[model samples]
Target chain A: MKADQTLDCIGLYCPIPIVKIATKIKDLKTGEILEVVGDDKGIKLDVPAWCQATGHELLGIEEQGGEIKVYVKKAPN
Target chain B: MAKKEKLTIAVLSGDLERALAAFMLAVTGASMDMEVSMFFTFWGLNIVKKNEGTMKSKGLMKKMLNMMNRGGSKRLKLSRFNMLGLGTWMMKDLMKQANMPSIDEYIAMAKDMGVELIACTTTCGVMGISPEKDSFRSEVGSLAGAAYFLSEARKSGVTLFI
Candidate 1:
């Protein structure tokens, strides 16, 4: 999928990947899409929860080959 | 957008393991756009101690307590299995292998994310820790009492006492 930016946080654990994602999301323009890939055990829940709390739109979450991919659309500030 | 949820984390342990665990929650909460704060009380105040040593030889018991918390956060031990400080080392290694941010890094991020770090005035007094002379980090939001924490928690949707 097309994304304004792709953040590869694979191998990073909880809070780090999410933290990186949170920091990167701020750099995107409103309506820009962010694609994040992480293999942390908690990434599945963490990504969506982050989106919910930050008022962003979680367009999709996919899992393949034991990796998690999350698509987030930047919310208008 | 709906009003962001507010979270209050009460860190009541000085153990490295527990303190790191609680900070993980605080950092995550703050990143999620929540209004997050932590009340550092009792033994937990050790994490913010700038001075390594206090009145060590004042009394036998106080001396022992001072020895247990002689240094800053670096001297913190795991709540259990702290054999010759090996347990603390093991945990840090594990955190490293897991690619988790170090405890210090998490605390710094929480500060940057605007997480309020409050030291309990009563705890400091009871523990003979002077908030003024202790030289805690400047990130500390306030030296406050239970009443103040209670008021904040009353307005918080999520309150966690770790």
Candidate 2:
């Protein structure tokens, strides 16, 4: 999915990737999409769980080789 | 977004891994727009001590206890596979390689994220630790007993003991 901002979380582990995504999402405007790419296996689950918990919209996820890309839309204030 | 949720974590262990987990949860909860509070008691109080080695305590027993423990985040050992601190060193190196923040950095992040760090007053009194003696970290928000933590825990959406 195309996004307004791309955050690279390569090499980070669980919680850190989620933490970074949460922090980065704050910089984007409400309804803007954020594309997060990471190598951490936990990202696939963490991103969706984070979105579900925080009320953000998880657009989709794509996996290529060992890398994963997740798109999340910021929730309105 | 839903209403702001609350998370209360009781940090009861001083081990590196446990401390790391508590801080990780605290920061994540805060990032998710939750009000997070960490209650430090027993060995967990070590994580909030100033790393400076010069903290002095009165009385022979207090001095002995201080010398044996030398409480601080940097001196924490792993609960298992410590290998006399070698394993902890290796684990920290791996964490650094993964771009993970150290425990101290996590403390700073928690502070920046507005996570409350509350020291256990009961533990402090029992352990002969005087918070006013400049032993605890300045980031500590308040000194409260289990009653305060329990009240907060009762109101929290999620409460954990680590």
Best DockQ among the predictions, by candidate number: 1
List, residue by residue over A22-71, the lDDT tens digit for candidate 2.
88988999999999999988888888889988889999999999999999
For all predictions in the order shown, the interface RMSD in Å is: 1.6, 1.7
Model 2 Cα shift for residue B38 (angstroms) = 0.3
TM-score of chain A of each: 0.94, 0.96
Which residue runs of candidate 1 sit more than 4 Å off their true CA positions? Answer: B51-68
Full-model lDDT, candidate 2: 0.89
Model 2, which residues run further than 4 Å from truth? none
Question: Which tens-of-lDDT digit does each residue in A11-74 have in candidate 1?
Answer: 8888888778888999999999999988876888888888878889999988899888899999
For model 2, how many clashes? 0
lDDT of 2 by residue, B1-162 (tens): 466899999999999999999999999998888999999998998899889866667777877777787888999999999999899999999999878999999999999989999999778755557755377888898888879999999999999999
